[model samples]
Target chain A: MFKPFAFTLAAAVLLTGCSAQSGAETQGGGLADSLPSLTGDYVWTVNAQKSTVKFEADYNGAFSADFSRFAAAIKLNPDAPETGEIHAVVDLSSVRADDKDVTNNLPTPAWFDIKMHPVATFKSDQISKTDAGRFIADGTLTLKGISKPAALTFDLKTDGNAATADGNFTVNRMDYQVGTGSDFKDESWVKFPVKVSVRIEASR
Target chain B: MSASVKSTYTKTAIWLHWMIAALIIGQLIGGKVMHAMDPAPLKFELYQLHKSFGFIILALSVARLLWRLGHKPPALPDGMKPFEKIGAKLSHIAFYILMIGIPISGWVMVSSSPYIIETKIFKLIPVFDLPGVPRTEGFNALTKDVHEYMAIAIAALLVLHIGAALKHHFVEKDDVLNRMAPRIKVRR
Candidate 1:
């Protein structure tokens, strides 16, 4: 087997400063207010060259993004797997979402501007399973000064040797004030059903 | 009779020829089996071995080809048919092309893959030197596809050559077999 070098992401952390301060002024300590007791590092690699976003999401691109920056830990009963808890932090400001100029354009005012607010974090409240055996983790996603409830569907498996988890979810940028810097079609909107996947090994 | 053919082959030359032949066939078999296997660490390891042997084939085949061309092979007995000579030359040309192509293509494909861990064969000599290529998510797939198709081409040519040789030996009572099979004349 190949060695799995892993780490978790905190949206590369820069955005975390401004957003954490904003959340303290409003929602209080951002996701720190609701933390998951899990501890383990998870790596998410995002190849903007590999990622594609459309109004309609495709599942096969249900892939991973490298987050050599952050880690995660989970607490769930084997008997009541549905009652699981997990948390993930991404260097929201580290947008591997584009290369060079495109990247700068994306994390700017009209988009996910990492300049003013750089960190985006998530904390799960409920973890349940579908009839088809996939996981649905519902949580609050905190970015900038906004906290919104979002759910991610994960195909997760755990064994004594290692654990793997993957999920893809799409949400509109407008809901998070991530909009184009324009007027006319002001009702105009672009949603990024950002595809995300995670694979990690736990040491204890 | 050619002066080179009158004398028997040197042991090293003979060994190099048969070894190249045997390993090329072995590499071909390994390539076929590797294709059917699922993607796993073990499967990847098998492919690594196949390419290692493939490099050996290229080297030995080159030696054998040079020895054959410079040292003329045993001539056919008097009155050999013209088509038999033509067939022998065509088959050899096909074999040489494939022997060189298969390994070169495999090396290129391996070099292009980002997932490839070790480029060394037998812990010596760097293999498939083209780096900076991503095997899993980029241009490597196209070369792999071409390598596979060309393997089929080589296999087809091999079958035709073997079948024709067998026909000449068992059915036609011709000297074609005697030229390559050293012991047949003694048996007759």
Candidate 2:
């Protein structure tokens, strides 16, 4: 489902305008946090070996895969998470699925279209701490040349200097045309919703 | 000659025989079509169906083999030479091997694949992968090649199997084909 470039450009602008307005409102009022130890402005270094970004595609059973290469830039004083930003970039070409066919199909035009869109990026417009002591990052995910609203909710656990954040979010593959067109339009073969889970181990 | 009498197959045996035959034929064709097509959602669906039918064929083969063990099949038609009898027995053995081997190899191929895809029969029945089977590229490739070649072997065997049956019915004018034939009025 290739939307015209001109039309999508206009839509992108409109979506961005809405996100910015909502972001401002959320940031102005949502700063309540209870995790005092996590309240710091230190730039954490992600331990690549310990971090994993995986997505599951439901077919017969879930066809699970992980992006071998991904990076996250998180600036946060967990006590005032509203002022922080969460930016993540995943190299889609580095996706490895447990099924060879799925791994091969992911880069094709009907799937991730890696040749055209090699990287999927998420930039948070607003970050907030929940009462349950978890954090949520409201962001725009740019994937396959299309941008859509996405949110990542994570539980941040700090051990002295090291921090581990594990979270999961589901995205409809149909929205970004990840697995659309031909027979994939139906949910029979491969389901539409792809659950993306992330574990980031980082230290200041 | 008394050991080589002709008799119609039992109804259960005949049913399992024909059901497996029909499913095997479908699986063969589906396998070929799916292998030749480019990777797409339809191809994926075909692959799944192929696996489902493969499992069905394997299960029916097991049942047929078990049934055959308990209930003796009609012996070879009278007037057949010793060599012919041995050939028929050996061919039947080979058929059983392929019937079971092809599907198992396919199962192993999927199981040992580095990209862990769960096997579900007809998208309804969830089948687990071979336990303790390490997921390795080499193992997966070996099993894949074995599965494909065994399927080809079965195809070749089918030509001989069907041709021999046809020969028995038309050229030899024997009850060999009719023994397994569905609802043939064998007036002896």
Winning model by lDDT? 2
Instruction: State candidate 1's DockQ.
Output: 0.01
Could you tell me which 10 consecutive residues in candidate 1 chain A have the lowest summed lDDT? A9-18
When only the first chain is scored, the TM-scores of the models are: 0.59, 0.79
Task: Report how far residue A147 has shifted in candidate 1, in Å.
Answer: 13
Q: Cα miss at B167, model 2 (Å)?
A: 1.1
Please give each candidate's TM-score.
Answer: 0.47, 0.55
- Put down candidate 1 lDDT per residue, B1-188, tens digits, no spaces: 44554545545655775677678678788888887885554675786688788788878777777877777655654555799778778887888888877778887787765333455676577664665555443467788897888889888887887798788778877656555553323543
User: Which prediction has the highest DockQ against the true structure?
Assistant: 2
**TM-score of chain B, per candidate?**
0.79, 0.93
Which residue pairs clash within candidate 2?
A: A98-B115, A98-B116, A99-B115
The window of 10 residues in a row where model 2 chain A has the poorest summed lDDT is A5-14
The lDDT values for all models are 0.53, 0.71
lDDT of 2 at A42: 53
Error of 1 at B50 (Å): 1.0
